[model samples]
Target: MSLSGKLETDVELKASAQQFHEVLCSRPHHISNVSPSKIQGVQLHQGEWGKEGSVIICNYIHDGKAKVSKEQVEKIDPVNNSVTYKVIEGDLLNEYKSFKITVQVTPKGTGSVSHWTYEYEKLHPGISHPETLLQFAAELSKEIDSHLTSAK
Candidate 1:
């Protein structure tokens, strides 16, 4: 595999697209309460919640291993319902030189489609691709999708 790569996952969620976008933009801090099994907590280290340039620290569990990701909100597009996060510090940094995750939601028939795009550069050629992390994000999305779907 290449040292630098991108992974895109489209998860179809049975929830309102606007609501999903709102959750990602304005209410991401509440994600822990909405889906504790996927995310334990999220705190704003700088700037305001859901705004660009904000730094967020996320505590989550991936494959039963606890991980912390310090990320900055790089971009937010309300019209497109997209949010991008660039990871600055955390365990992944030890293995990867840089990482970014973008979440986009689009309305589909009777529901919404979540697009997860992961862009990363590995520290070395021997480092494995971040498939597990992608899986973790997909799992988290599924959990949130269910939570929102059930609440409505």
Candidate 2:
């Protein structure tokens, strides 16, 4: 089997596409305020928030376990409402040689749709696809959507 793979999922959100994209690119730290149970905190380590090449460490919970990831902002496309992050260090690197995550939000009527993509190369074929991680992302998106919708 190939050691590299990609997985993607789309989540429907009640918040506008601009709002969703802005939250991720401009103020990702607010995610903890929206979903404290899923995302413990997002701390900027280098550069600045929303800027390319910046680094942030995210503390989160997955599968009932707390985990951390240090990621660099690879790209931020305001026109496309997309943001890409490359994992530089984290628990996920234990099984995968490299991991990249991209999120894009698109307008849909008065609401929006958030697309999450995960690309990774495994260290060995023994590792399974990160389906659980995608599920975690989907749930987290829903939580953030709920908070955004309620706050408005």
**Candidate with the greatest TM-score versus the true structure:** 2
Off by over 4 Å in 1: none
Candidate 1 steric clashes = 0
Model 1: how large is the Cα RMSD against the reference? 1.2
After TM-score superposition, what is the CA distance of residue 126 in candidate 2 from its true location, in Å?
1.1
Structural similarity to truth (TM-score) of each candidate: 0.95, 0.98
lDDT string for model 2 (36-121, tens) is 88899999999999999999999999889999999999999999899999999999999999999999999998899999999999
Q: What's every prediction's RMSD, in angstroms?
A: 1.2, 0.7
Off by over 4 Å in 2: none
Quote the lDDT for 142 in model 2.
95
Worst 10-residue stretch by lDDT in candidate 2? 143-152
- lDDT, model 1, position 45: 94
